[model samples]
Target chain A: MAHKSAGRSALARVLAVLETFDQDNSALTVSRISKRSGLPVPTVYRIVAELLEMGLLERGSDRRLHVGVRLWEIASRAPRALGLREAAMPFMEDLHAATRQHTQLYVLEGCDALVIERLSTRSAVTNVTQVGDRQPLHATTGGLVLLAHASLHMQDSFLSAPMRAYTPNTPTDPAELRRILANIRTRGYVVCDGYITPDALGVGTPVYSPSGDVIAALSVVVPRDGAQPMTHVRALRLSSRGITDALGKPQVRHGPQNIRLFPFVNNEQL
Target chain B: MAHKSAGRSALARVLAVLETFDQDNSALTVSRISKRSGLPVPTVYRIVAELLEMGLLERGSDRRLHVGVRLWEIASRAPRALGLREAAMPFMEDLHAATRQHTQLYVLEGCDALVIERLSTRSAVTNVTQVGDRQPLHATTGGLVLLAHASLHMQDSFLSAPMRAYTPNTPTDPAELRRILANIRTRGYVVCDGYITPDALGVGTPVYSPSGDVIAALSVVVPRDGAQPMTHVRALRLSSRGITDALGKPQVRHGPQNIRLFPFVNNEQL
Candidate 1:
């Protein structure tokens, strides 16, 4: 069941309802959902009634609907998301402790860099990346790392597309970006100084899966001034290797560890 | 929109299919979904087909249907789950750094202790609480903290119900548990040594919302031997106060910081 491109299916309509809730637009009335989803008001109510029944959608005392804990609970089991996040967490934590900057993990999805997990202290540089928020593959250090490891076909397609420049330092020329991607692959990491923001520097390394494929990117964001890029990269590579090792051996699963943690391994060993 | 306890609606059937997959059962076949959800094989096939189209479910190379990244993307926006997780992360990281043990943030959901976020290194205690997993109310320190703060009617109902005993230390008698909850209320923290596992000790404190209602609990798990349970509780209370202060200020909502970290505030200040 690839898709029902012939017409909008009933399930698509339900998904549209869920789509209306996001980081900014979390709580909404039925009419707002109808407006956002482009479905009729009556249809919104009917679907929301079902979602509410399933506890997938909750109505607050204020009578606005929200994405429910049940939905988040079910979604937490997605292997591509939480599984990767789980494998990356301890390493990310260690990297954060060492660098005292922002540490982020990413996977390539739909030509955009999807942030799987991010850790930052309040003192981190002014970086505007959030987990699950997609960034342009050309603008982010993690994105370039993934693009470097991505299929040639995907690379070619990305190179042919126009690049958006957020700042003077963002690499906008496709040919130059292709060369940067090549350099990233050769070095196993990339340092994008002021790519997203003027005051930020991003250093990213490759994270491998058990099958030895570069499945994700682990990146750190530090302040541009006096930033030791090589030092950060070295620390990041250490964590990346740890995550890779954890993935190589099937990670022992335990917790509600954010409700539990993987006590099977030791901190010093990593 | 409460619930139709009568005949199943189409959305109800869809929810049944989604609910069949959890922390343990991530992948399932059409037949398995049918067996667990109690829907017909053909019906399961039909719904799975639609779910696949919507990218709510994905088929592996092995062809086992699993929860989709798209669904997780949608659910990640859940304010209660990720919102709290985001607000709690930096402090949890600080606590984890200080204790180097398991750090968890939990919200009370229904009658169970729902884990919203957890962080730990490889050498923490043996506890099986995941971000989305639920634990018995009377068995976990976080659960008891929330129970202590719950409404009187809710407290009475829980106290009047049968409590399961997982270990010799897990409190089963409502009267004894009630006294323990009272102590928790008086001291503003709870320490449960060997409550779930003989080797693990759990220390917990309350996390309040902006309105001062107990919305969640911040907890830590350490090795039972040389645990210094009171010491852990003291550290937990510090982070709990930080979390509560951050929450009390209408927690600056930004990113997946973990469970509930106030990104707007700096860590040095905390």
Candidate 2:
């Protein structure tokens, strides 16, 4: 059934139309979407029309296509992102208030670290991360923390790939990266100085679910030359614990689920 | 074509399925989704399978399904929501910090106020609103403000219906509501006390796009029994203006376009 089409699923094609609109290209003509998605112009038009009718896609006053609020409304209802964010918010806010830096929450999405939420200050160090953005497992503090607790197979797959280097200080070699991951596992935290950008350093800790599975990573980005990043590690760990504790609460079960699904595993796997 | 099948398109059915998930019911069994969307269980399953394969939905640990991270990612990339939120954030942050209350940014979405972003303290007054949640035009300060500045046709159509009243203080009579909207239009801000919830008060102001259209509404929610809600009206107006000014900047143009598709319009013929 899977091999029926090297041509992607209709759903995938539909997603392709949505994926075409991003931070850089927010609005696109049907031709642009067609070219980007590699779908025929007629197909793009039909799909776009269907999506618009479904309120999954919308057209702007400029006659260009964009994502629809209905999509966001549906996505926002997702328990994993919004629920976890809701539970973590009070704690994240406490941490943010204390540090007044960049506070972020991330979860493992495939092999990459997906930032679910982030709060930044103008006076904080510069970082390339944004909410709903992704970063590699080897380069980010949050990614490394998640990678540290990930399944051995996931770790091996990640380390086997040639890690992209954002800064000279990033660990690209599999052996060295393996050692770093081990260290993170042992220390219960990961700190990367200038791994992503030259001017910033990040420290991250894991957030566990009720089952003690490391479901997400919490991190703080600070200027590389500023106060010891280690000092903030305690706060990060505390905030992570608070979030995890909140997740374990019955009230949180009533909150939205922010689960990320990987086809390779079913519910029983967790 | 429009009259076929209860005026519902295939796309509309798909949207209905998506819309069934909200903050209250983020994860749903296939049966629940089918029931909520009024689609047959078989059709819901088929479409949901496609949506799952497309990364728009994910199965949770409970074996139920929720909105997928990919959906949020795609929606976040929509220029209207993400773009407007990005430009509005710094200003929103400033407003939140200043007011120490719930500061929200909402755009008119299909005759309702759809909150795109919000920042609040944990101890702040309780609000029924959430990011991606929708409020009726007559119930929220933001909604009222947006409705006041809306086209005459929109105003007439909105007031023509029997509006749902959340609290006794909520104006159910069209004449009284009309006066309130007119006052908002004249005063340039709205101080709504116990309109939605008896314990909260809302202060709202309009946000304009570069073209001078009232593209969004900015509001602050505070405890009803605390200081007068009008005290924050000026601050809310300032922040709204600040967001409008920031949105007008040249670099802020390319944002997710889907967020800009406001759903509510006056269909006088209806």
- What is every candidate's alpha-carbon RMSD to the true fold? 6.3, 5.6
> Worst ten-residue run, lDDT, model 1 chain B?
B261-270
DockQ of each: 0.36, 0.36
Name model 1 segments beyond 4 Å from true.
Answer: A1-7, A253-270, B1-7, B250-270
lDDT of 2: 0.76
TM-score of chain A of each: 0.89, 0.89
Q: Please provide TM-scores, in order, for all candidate models, with all chains considered together.
A: 0.88, 0.89
DockQ measured for candidate 1: 0.36
**Residues A160-262 of candidate 2: C-alpha lDDT, one tens digit per residue:** 7777777789899999988998998888998898888888889999887876778788999887886587789989888888887777665511112333322
lDDT of each: 0.78, 0.76
- For model 2, report the TM-score of its A chain: 0.89
lDDT of 1: 0.78
* Superposed Cα deviation of residue A170, candidate 1 (Å): 1.3
- Model 2 chain A scores worst on lDDT over the 10 consecutive residues at A261-270
